[model samples]
Target: MQYRRFGKTNLNFSVFSLGTMRCLSSPKNVRQTLIQAVELGINHIETASSYGKSEEYLGEIINSELPVSRSQIHITTKIPPTADADKMRWWIDESLKRLKLDYIDCLGIHGLNTWEHFDFIKQKNGCMQAVEEAMADGRVKHIGFSSHGSLEVIIATINTGLFEFVNLHYYYFFQRNYPAIKLASLKGMGIFIISPADKGGRLYTPPPALKSLCQPFSPLELNYRFLLSDPRISTLSVGPAIPKELEEPLNFADRTEKLTIEEITIFNSLENHRDSVLGTEKCSQCYDCLPCPENINIPEVLRLRNLAIAYDMAEYGKYRYRMFENAGHWFPGMKANRCTECGDCLPRCPEKLDIPKLLEDSHNRLKGKEGRRLWG
Candidate 1:
C-alpha cells in the first residue's frame, strides 16, 4: 500500500484508513478486519464516540491483541460538540479507559455543521477548554474538526490556527470540499476523507446518470482513483462492512497503475452532466452551503429531490423528508415554502446556485403546495 505524508506531521499514513462505523456488530469480525488491514500495511484506524459501541469494540480488540506502542500505529477519535466541557472531558477519559490506550494520536471536534456551532466551540470555553486540556495533559496529541459545511467555515476554522487536522467529505461524486482541502494542505493540516464511496449508498450501483459519466471505468474504481489522484488527500476512511471490503481497497492500493488520460476526461465530463441534471438554480446536493438562516438542510432536501427525479424514487424522497421533518432538524420557518426570495444564499454558494428560486420550486414539489410562502 502507498503511504503519504500526513500534512506537516512526520508520520506517513496509508492512503486508505479503516473506519469503524460498521464494525460494531461483531467484535471478532472487527478484530480480524483490523488485523488483516494492519497486516496489509494499513496502520491508521479511525473511530468516533457517536458511532454507538464502536469505541468499546475497538478498545477490546486493541487491549486483547494489538500492540500498545504509539509508534506502531496512529489512532484518531472524535468528541461530539453536544457534550459540555466537563462531560467532554469525562468522555475523553472514558474513551481512553475503553480504548485501553495511553493517548489518542489525533482527536477532532465532531460534526461541526454551521458557523454558530464553530463559534460555540471557540467562544463558550467548554469544548475548546476541554480540547486544550486534553492536549496539555498528553491525552490527545493533535486537535482537529470534522465539518459538514462550506469552504467559508473551513477557512474560518483554519484562520483560528487551532487545529492540526480536519476530516471532511471529498469524493469523485462530490468535490465540494476540494478548495478547503487544498487550503488545509497549504496551512499544514492533515486531511482525512470520510466515506467517499458510500455517500449516496453502495458502489455496486450508482445513479444511471452518474454511471454514464464514469464511462471508461467501473464506478467503484473510478471513485477511488478520483480521490487517489489528489496528492493533498492523506487518507480515506472507508467503513468496511466485512473483511473483503477491507481487502478490496488494499488490492486497489497495491496496484501501481495510475488513472489514464481517458479516465480523467470521463471524470471531468461529470461537471457538465451534474450541472445539467441538477440545474443552475438548485442545490447540487453537496451540503456545502448549510446552516441556513432558518435551519433548513438545503443539501439534504435537494438530495431527496434528486433521488426522486433521477431515480424515480419519489416515495423514498417523501419518506426521508418526513423523517427530517419529524426529527425537527428542519425548521418549519425555513421550509422551502418560507423562502422570501431575499437572495441571501446565492453569493455564498461556490456553485453559484440560484437558492431562492430552487427553494421555491422544492417547496412546491415536496409539500405539494401551490405558491410561495414568505419567511416572517
Candidate 2:
C-alpha cells in the first residue's frame, strides 16, 4: 500500500483507511474486516464515539484477535459537538476505554456542519477546550475537526491555526474542496477525506456517462484513482460493507498507471454535465449550500430522493422525509415542496446543484408512495 505523511502528525498513513461506520454494529464482522485490513497493509482505522459499537469492536479485535501493537496502527476517533467540556472529556476517556488504548493518534470534533457549529467549538468551555485538555493530558496526540460545512467555514477553521488535522468531504466527482485541500497542506495540516464513494452511492455502479468515460477501468478504481491523483490527500476513509470492498482500493495503491492529459480533460468535461452524467437524482451528499434561509435540508432531501428512485424505496424515503420535515431543528422553513426558488442557496453550492428544482421533484414523488424498502 502507498503511504503518505499525515500532515504534522509525523505518521505515514495508508492511502486507504478503514472507516468503521457500518462494521461496528457486527462485532464478528468487524473483527474479521479489521484483521483483513491489517493483513492487507491498511494500518489506519477511523471510527467515532457516535458510530454505535465501533470503538468497542476495535478494542475487542485489538485485545483478542489482532497481533498488531498500538504503535503499529493509527487510530482516529471523534467526539460530537453537543458534548460539552465535561462530556467531551468523558467521551474521550470512554473511547480510550472502549478501544483498550492509552492514547488516540488523532481526535476530531465530529460533524461540524454549520458556522454556528464552528463557533460552538471555539467557545472557552466547549469542545475545543476539551480537546486541548485531552492533548495536554496525552489522551490525544493530535487534534482535528470533521466538517460537512461550506468552504468558507473550512477556510475559517484552517486559518485559526489550531488543528493538527481536518477531515472533510472530498472526491473526484465533488472537487469543491480541492482548493481547501491545497490550503490545508500549505498550512501543514493533515487532510482526510470521508465517504467519497458511499456519499454518491455510485462508486460500485458509476453513472453510464462516467463509466463510458472510464472504459476498461472499473468505476470503483477510477473513483479511488482520481482521489489518489491529488497528492495533498493524506487518506481516503472508505465505509466498506465487507472485506472485499475494504481490500479493493488496496489493489491499485502501488500501481504505476496514471490518468493521461486527454483522460483528465474528458473527466473534467463531465463536470459541466454532471447532473446528466451522474443523474441529478443521486445526491452527492455534499452539504455545502446549507443553513438554507428557508431551512430546507437540500442535501438530505436529495439523498432521500435518490434512495427513493435508485432502490424504489419510496415509502422508506417518505418516512425519512417526514422525520426531517417534522424535526424543527433539522428542516424548519421549507418542506420539500415549499421551496420558493429564491436562488439564495445556489451561490453557496460548491457542486452547483439546483436546489429548488431538486426539492420540488423529491417531494412530488416520495410523499405519496408506498412499499419502499432499503436497497440490499
Candidate 3:
C-alpha cells in the first residue's frame, strides 16, 4: 500500500486505512483480514469505543504479535463527545485496557456532529478537558475528531486549531465537505475519509446508471480512485468484512498516480448524463439559496431528490428521505413539503428551480402510500 504525509503530524499514513467497524461479527475472519492488511502495508487502523467487540479483537491480535510488529502500525480509537469530563476520562482508561496497549497513536472525539455536540466539547470540564488529560498522561500522541455533521459545523471544529487530524465523509456523490477539506488541508491536519464504499452512495450495491458511469472498473474502485485523486485527503477508511473485501486495497496498491485523463472525461460524461436525466428544472446545489427560515437543509433535500429522479432508485431514495424524518439537528427538517413557499429562496436560486413545484413533485413521488417499499 502507498502512503501519504499526514499533515503536521509527520506520520506516513497508508492510503488505505483499516476501519474495524464491521469486525464486530466474525472475529477470526476479520482478524485474519486485518493481519493481511498489515502484510500488505496498511499501517493505520481506526476503531471506536462504541463499535462492539472491535477493541477486544485488536487487543487479542496485538498482544500475540511481536513488539516490532505492533510498533510498525498506528492505532486510533474514539469516544463520543459528552459534557461529563469524568466519564470521558474513564472512557480513555477503559479503552487502553481493552486494547492492552500502553499508548495509542491517535485518539479522536467521535461524532462531534452538531452544534450541540460541539457545545458539549467546549463546556466547562467537558470532552476536550478529558482528552487533554489523556494526552498529558502520555497515552495519546495526537488529537483528532470524526464527524457526521453539517459542513459549517465540521469547519467550525477544524478552525478551533485543536485537532491534529479529522475523519469525515467525502466522495464523488457527496462533495458537501469540499470546503471543509480545503480548510483542513490548509491547517495541515490529517484528513481521513470515512466509509467511502458503504455510505458513499451505497456503491457496494451500485445503481446501473452509476455503474455505467464508472465503466470498466467497479463503482467501488472508481470511487476509491476518485477520493485518492485529491491531495487534501490523507487516507480512506476501508472496512473489510470478509477476506476478499481486503483485496481491493491491495489491487490499488499503486495509489501514487493522479486521476487519469480518461477518468476525468468519464466523470464529465456522468455529470452531463445526470443533468440531462434530472431535467433543466432542478436544484444546482450552489448553496446560494440557503439559510432557510424554517431551518431546512435545502441542498441535502434537493440532492436526494436528484438521485431519486436521475437514478430511478425509488426505494433507496425514499429510505434515505425517511432518515430525515425525526433526525433532529443531524438531518434537520422534513421533506420539501415544508417549503411553505414563502418566496424567500425564489430569487436566490440560480437555476430558477421553481423550488416550490420541485419540492411538491419530490414529496409526491417519495412519500408514503404509493412509494416503493425498501428492498428485502
Summarize candidate 1's per-residue lDDT along 1-376 as a digit string, tens digits.
9898887665688988989888667888888888887888888898888778878888877755764444778888887775368888898998888788889988888777667767767876567888889889998888888876556777788778888788887776456577888889989988998887665234654656545656666677777877787777888887787777776666677543466788778766755555566665545555666657766667766765764554344544544455433433112224566565666666778888777676666665666422332212
Q: Which ranges in model 2 have alpha carbons more than 4 Å from their true place?
A: 207-209, 255-258, 272-293, 297-336, 341-376
lDDT of 3 by residue, 1-376 (tens): 6799888788898998999987567768767878787877889999999888888788888757523377788899998899999999899999999999998889999888889898987787888898898899899888999998888899999998989999998988788899999999999999999988777777777778667767877777778889888888899898988767887656875765798898888778878877998888656779887888766677877887887777655655666677655555545666678889898988999888887787778777766544332222
* Model 2 per-residue lDDT tens digits across residues 37-138: 988888889999978888988887775677677688999998877537888878888999999988999998886766787788778898777788888889
Per-model TM-score on C-alpha atoms: 0.79, 0.79, 0.89
Error of 2 at 225 (Å): 1.5
Q: Pick the lDDT winner.
A: 3
TM-score of model 1 (CA atoms)? 0.79
Error of 2 at 189 (Å): 1.0
The collision pairs in model 1 are: none
| Candidate 2 vs 3: which has more lDDT | 3
- Pitting candidate 1 against candidate 3, the one with the higher TM-score is 3
14 in model 2: Cα distance from truth in Å?
0.3
Error of 2 at 359 (Å): 5.0
> lDDT score, residue 327, model 2?
40
